[model samples]
Target chain A: MVVVSLNNVTKKIGSKTIIDNLSFDVHAGEVFGFLGPNGAGKTTTIRMLVGLMKITSGDIFIDGHSVKANFEEAISKVGAIVENPEMYKFMSGYDNLKHYARMVKGVTLERIDEVAELVGLQNRMKEKVKTYSLGMRQRLGIAQALLHRPKVLILDEPTNGLDPAGIREIRDYLKRLAREEDMAVIVSSHLLSEMEMMCDRIGIIQNGRMIDVQLVNDMVNGGNVSYVISAKPIDQAFNVLQHAFEGINVKMTKQHLHVEGESVDVPKLVKRLVENQCDIYEVKQVNQSLEEKFLEITSEKGGIA
Target chain B: MGLLANEWIKIFKRKSSYIMIGILAIIVLVAAIGMTFINNQGTETGDNGNWKTALEAENKDLKEELKSTPGPYKKEVERVIAENEYRITHEMPRVTSYNVWTFMNGMMGLVDIVALFTIIIAAGIVASEFSWGTIKLLLIRPINRAKILLSKYITVLLYALFMLAILFVLSFILGAAFFGFEQNQPHLAYLDGQIVERAQIPFLLSQYALSSVGLLIFTTMAFMISAAFRNSSLAIGLSIFLLLVGSIVTSIIAGFFDWAKYLLFANTNLLPYFGTGTPMVEGMTLAFSLIVLLVYFIIFLVVAFWAFVKRDVAA
Candidate 1:
């Protein structure tokens, strides 16, 4: 089932359109990544889905319940962490969970403990949130969002402030949650590589519009192939590769030439480079990283990523 | 119901709330101790003073009447003796646990501490969400916005109740310890309109209790003010300012207009069961105060709910 659906959702703040007729679906058990740059309407869309903000136009549905008409019922099925995870900092982590647990239905004390364990905060659950590190706070946020056993989890930039290790832990944990727990997760991030690693499908949003919705494999074109040609006198190396490989694009960085072409084109280029007395030190095909893809999409609309 | 329980937990969980309770306790203790010392210091030390001379003259007149009585003057003599004994021992007019409470209640105006505390505590009852950046978290909880607001208002009332209960207990304990619970034998005869002898002490206590209900209404009005204004400083500041200025405004307005009775704070203490034992005016009844408060309470609650649910959590 589609756990969440936005049909042409549009929202405007004053004269600026923050979310422009965006549409997407989060299926059950799928880790969906909402990829966008800053001000690309990722938070706005999530806020609308969670009923924090009204939709200027269009409709949002959570498990087939209209967010506008049946907001309470719709929002009950959703647990979200928007922007930053804010909680009662004076309360212990366990107490914070307990406090939020009461707001949700059928959330038992046992479930609270379970969620704490799931977020890897079981050891420090009794400690005050003020004493928690930023990573622990992020985990606690996830735990709070997951406390009610929500069918859909919407987190915006859940891993933004974390160190690399913290990021990996959250990524692995969320992936496990989606696969094992059968939750449809909508994770928003500016870092496309993280999303690519964790998300099964991604919705690329830019300037308030959902530019594209595709599987991770399709977004990368099964990780689009690129060739890096390194030959002495790099200016000549670029001319040699471009002439030999027609219809292929080339961009020159300081020490090497980056060429986007077929994987098979590398050997042909290497042979030509040696023949032209261009000292060929490296001829390698590089896979386009998710960061590169994200930049390509968001940069067109002037997004700051 | 679970949500309401959650709201209650929030009140107990925050450290600031406990601080508020502690402040209330301190205020009550200080007031009780200070009043006791002042009262003791002001009493006449010597027996044969000016007050005694006047009393002796009155006693002589009453004795003359006893001599005129041909039948049993024994009862009259006993009554006069009791009166003189009471006069000599410092009957301590208006001094019971309930009377101290009334006196302390009046002194609420003199000291702005309780009013300050009420504003500080009650103002954040609703508006704290904005300051703490918790509005979005609270709104996404799936409960109705009306319930959210009602829950907050209920929490503030609970705080008020808890504070008042603490003050009541502390005052009584301190008052009894210092003043030595003197049976509170009613001495003021014909209080307001009713006839009274030395046997209506329990009745007086009950009347004071009824009168304190008026004070509770005043607290609720402050709660509504806090809820209406979402900023703690503004909420607390405005409510206290209005409270301090309200009586002055009432008297000033009354100087020009008569409809000032409808103003909420004017007749908040509806049962002035203190001085003269009756309401200043015939119409300033407890029921009238309650009705006006209910109207204001409903309006304030409606506005709080509407603002909470509809206002964007932009922060």
Candidate 2:
């Protein structure tokens, strides 16, 4: 089920368009990653969804309520952490959560304790927020956001200042939340590797426009895959394959000949190479990582990587 | 209602709030101790009967001095003679009594301290949320923006009333300890070209309530600044500067411009209309000042709520 939807959302501040006619949907029990370079309107879109900003033209619906008209109803289903997870420095972590819990209904003491343990902050809940580390504060922020059992959770740069272990911890918790709680999670970040590991699907945005939205595996290895051919007499094998697979792009790098095609064509190409007096040693498929794919897509759209 | 409670809890949790309360308590204690010392000195020196005789002597001296004094000094000497005669006929006690009326009357000075602390809290309440980036957390919740702002404003007024109550109870306790309890005392006021006497308790309570008119206006001004500007230091600095020098500046301008009567500072003090003193400008009546205050009060609230609701939380 689609828990969050943005329909032709556009935001203009004075004459400059910040987010232009953007549209997307996030389904329940899935992790959706929003990817963009600097100034790509990722934060702006998140702000509109959370009702911190007003949409200039279109509407954002969360759990069947419009953000522009039914703000309180729409926002009740969303729990977000925009930018850094800032909180009252003078208050204890537990007090901060309790303070926020009062603003929403049905958030009892047991719920607070449950979230605290979920975020691994049960031990440090009594300490003042000023004394907490950045990672600890981030955990506490997530705990506060989860108190009311929101249908959708949004986080912008959740791993911005965390070490590797902290990043892994957040990534693990987000995945668990989506699978166990059946919640839709929308996260925006510039860290491609982390997003690659954490997200099931990603939407690329640039210059207030959404470039594409696709599944993570499809985006990385869905289309034409490249295969490296290691055979004897490398130059001869490269020429034979190029001639046999006419109009198909092929290249030779050092000791191997690279061919681009579907997995089904691998046996046919091998048969042809064998018939051309070339001995096939090994054939390996080259799978592109999300980082390379992201660079390729963004650069194709005239954006600096 | 829940929002207001949230704000109230947030305020008391901060150390600075407690510091402000501590400073107020220390100031009141020191003043009470000083008054006690002065009262003890007066009693130790055996000056119990000197007040009446001294007033008589001063009355004779002032009457003689009025004959040869210059035009400017004559008005001052005649006023002194009138005050001395009133004290003699009314049998008013000296300052050394430290009675309930005296203690309550002395509390007028502490009102300014209350205003100062209240202004500090009011100025920082909204601005600090933005400065600390906690405003995003607040706005993302299920509450409306107007309710959030209203809760914060109400919290400030509640805090001010709490401080005022503390001052009243503390002064009453100290007054009873120093001068024992008196059944009936008259509070004297100069009103309508005559000296009118009123019940001490009601008169003192009115004085305290009237003084708070200025306190409320200044607190509203501070809150307006806080909501309009996201910078806490700027809000606190500008509002405090105005609170300290606003009246003096308005008085100086009133000399050159009669239109100054419409300024906020010129109308905030309602005590003059209650018989404690005279209005700052001639023809400035109680109803007129109240109307002026009501207008400014509405404007401040309108501007504050409008700005807070319309502003996009971009940061």
Candidate 3:
């Protein structure tokens, strides 16, 4: 089910368009990653979805309620952590959760405890937030956001300032929340590798515009992939493959000769190399990582992604 | 209502809130001690025996001294003689009398301290949420932005009322301890060119309540600044500076221009209309001052709520 939808949402501060006409949807039981460079309007879009900002034109609907008109009804379905997960420093972690729980109905003590244990903050729930580490504060923030059993959860830069283990812990927890609780999760970050491993689908945004949105697997493995060809008489093999695969890009690296084509072309290239008196030892298919794909797509626009 | 409770819990959890109450307690205690010491010194000097005879003697001495006093000092001396004669004729109690009403009256000056502390909290409540970045967490909830702002404002008013109650109850306790609970004392007021007497308890309570007008106005000013600017230090600094210097500046302006009566500070001190002092301007009546204060009060609240509701939590 589509849990969150943005339809032609645009935000303009004065004359400068902060977020151009953007549109996307997040479905249930999946992790949607919003990937963007700095100043790419990722936070701006998230803010509009959560009602922290006004949408200049268009609509955002959470759980089928329009955020612009039915803000209370729409926002009740969303739980978000924008930018840093800043909490009341003087309040204990438990008190902070309790404070927020009061605003939403049916948030009982058991629910609070359940979320605390889910976020792995059960032991330190009594400590003041000012005494908590950045990772601990992030966990507490997630705990508070989950108290209401929101249909959609949004977190901006959830892994920022977290250690490696902390990052892994949050990533693992978010995945569990989506699968086990059947909740749609939207996270925005600039960290590519984390998104590559954690997200099922990603929307890449640049300059207030969404450049592309695709499944993680489709993005990395669905294009004209390159194959690494290894053999003896490396210079001759490279020349034969270059001549055999006409109009296809082929290059020889330090360790192997690289040939770029669809997966089906691999066998034909190998047979041709064999027929050309070239010794072919190995033919390995190389899949591009999301980082490489991201660079390629963003570089096509002539700026940093 | 839940939002208000949330804000209440947040404010009470801070250490500064307790410190504000602590400071008020200490100030009241010190004032109590000082009043006791002065009363003891008056008793030791044998001036506490008969206030009527002492006033008559002082009146005669002041009149004799007025003959040789310069023109500049004559007015002050004559005012003193008039006050002493009025006290003697009206049978008003002596200042050295150990009574609860007198102590409660003395504690009225501490309302300024209450206003100062209340303004500090009021100024920081909204602005600090933005500065600390907690506003993002707050506004993402199910509540409306106006309700959130209203809750904070209500929390501030509740804190102010709490401090005022503490001051009143603590002063009552301290006063009853230092001086006997002497009821039925008439409060003397020099008004309309004569001395008039009214019931003490009601008069003192009204004075305390009336004195809070200044407190509420300054607090609203601080709150408006907090919402409009979202900078805690600037709000606290400017409101406090105005609170401290506003009266002096108003008087300076009032000395030169009759239009100064329309300014905020000119009308804050409602006690003057109750015969605590004369009006700053000649024709400024209690009704006029009350209207002026009400107008300013509405403006402050309108500005505060409007700014708070319209502001976008971009940061």
Candidate 4:
């Protein structure tokens, strides 16, 4: 089900367009990643989605309510953290959650405690947010956004300032929330690898316009899968694979042979290398990362990469 | 209501608010202690025992001066003569010792301190959110912009009232503790050739309310500046600067321009109209001042709500 939909939403600041005719839908039980480089209007789009900024033209709907006409109803179904989780440093972590919970109805103290545990901050909830590290702050922010049990959770640059472990923790936590709560999560990030592990589907935006939207699976291994073979005498292995698998795209890199083919053909190429008396030291399947896919998509559109 | 509680809690969580209240309380205690020490020096007037005869002689001399000089100071002299005659007839002593009522009256000036603290809160209540980058999360709540802004504005006014209560109640308690309620007389006023007598506590309370009219206006101005600009320093500085000098500037302008009657400070002190005193400008009536104040109050609120509701949360 489409939990949130942006129908041709446009945002213009003065004469310059910040987000132009952006359109997409986020479904429940799925993590949708908004990917783009810096200054690609990713943050602006998130701002409009949560009603922080106005849409110059077009409309956005959240849970069947129009965001422009019925803002309170639409936004009530969403919990978002735009930019950094800049909370009141003087207030304790629990107090910050309570503060946000007070803004919405039906949030009891138990719910506040439950969310604190969900974010793994229950032990430190009474401590001031100033004492929290960036990771703890991010978790507290997520905990705040979840207090109201919103149907949609939108986080812009959720991993902007976290170490690898913290980033992984957030990624796994978000994925679990999306699956267990059946909530639609929208995460925007410039890091391709993070999105690959976190998002189920992604929409790539560039220069205030969406360039591509696809399932993460199709985006990574939709067309061709590459295999990297590091063997003795790389040129011999390269020629053996090129001759055995006719019309296959094979390249001879330094000390390795890169072969582009299906998984079924990778083993066949490896068998032929051994039959031709070439040493098969190692053979590994290489999945094209979302970063390369992004470059490929941009280059296909003949735009600036 | 929830929003208001949230804002109220947010304010008290900071140390600055406690500091403000502490400073105000200390000022009152120090001022009272200073007065107590000065009065302990036994600076009693020699004429206190025969003040009726002294006032009678002063009235005779004032009547003589009234016959000789006729100028702008004439009305002041006439007012003094009328008050002296009324005092002598009523047997009210001019040189009374310090009492609880007098202490309460003296503490009325401390309403300005309450105003300063209130303005500090008003200035930061809205602007600090933006500066901290918390406005992004704040604006994303289920509440609409108008409701949120209204809650914040109401919180500021409530804070002003709370500070005023602290000042009044604390001063009253302190005054009663140090200076007993001995020989407290009714407040006397010379109004239109008549001596009006008012009970002391009611008179003091009304004086406090009248003084706080200026506080309320200055706090609202600070709030408006805070919402329009995301800089608490600018709001606090500008509002405080105006609060200190607004009336003085209005008086300077009133000397040449009659339209100065419409200035906010000219109308803030409603005590003149309530009690027996001349208006800041000659032609300003009670109704006229109230209307001017109402207009400025509305203008400040309208600008505040407009800026808060209409502007994009870019910061």
Q: Relative to the true structure, how large is the alpha-carbon lDDT of every model?
A: 0.73, 0.87, 0.87, 0.88
Per-residue CA lDDT of model 2 for B1-315, tens digit only, reads 789889999999988888988887787777778887887777754576788998898889878888898653454465556666777897874444557668668977798889888988999999999989999999999899999999999999999999988887787777777666775667666655456668877787788888999999999988999999877788889988998899999988876787999999999989877655556776788999999999999999999999899989876
List residue ranges in candidate 2 displaced over 4 A: A262-264, A274-282, B42-96, B179-184
Worst 10 residues of 4 chain B by lDDT: B69-78
**Runs with alpha carbons beyond 4 Å of true place in candidate 4:** A229-246, A261-264, A267-284, B60-75
Q: Estimate each model's TM-score.
A: 0.81, 0.93, 0.93, 0.94
Better of 2 and 4 by lDDT: 4
Q: Which 10-residue window in model 3 chain A sums to the lowest lDDT?
A: A261-270
DockQ of 1: 0.50
Candidate 3, A1-305: lDDT as tens digits: 99999999999999999898899999999999999888899998998899888899999999999999999999998888999999999999999999999988889999999999988899999999999999999999899889999989999999999999999999999999899989999999987899988899999999998889999989978988877889868888888877775568888887698878654477777788788787877888888888888988888875774
Candidate 1 matches the true fold with a TM-score of: 0.81
Tens-digit lDDT track of model 4 for A1-305? 99999999899998999898999999999999999889999999988888888889999999999989999999999999999999999999989998999899899999999999999999999899999999999999999889899999999999998999999999999999999999999999988889999999999999899989999989887977887889887777777777776557888889888877554476677778888889988888887887888888876775854
**DockQ of candidates 1 onward, in order?**
0.50, 0.83, 0.80, 0.83
Task: Pull out the clashing pairs in model 1.
Answer: none
Among all windows of ten consecutive residues in candidate 1 chain A, which has the lowest summed lDDT? A296-305
Of all true interface contacts, what fraction is found in model 2? 0.87
Q: Please write out the lDDT profile of model 1 over residues B64-179, one tens digit for every residue.
A: 77867644334445455455645656643323243443444443432245445655666776677667766777889878787877777676666655665565556556656655
Model 2 iRMS (Å) reads: 0.7
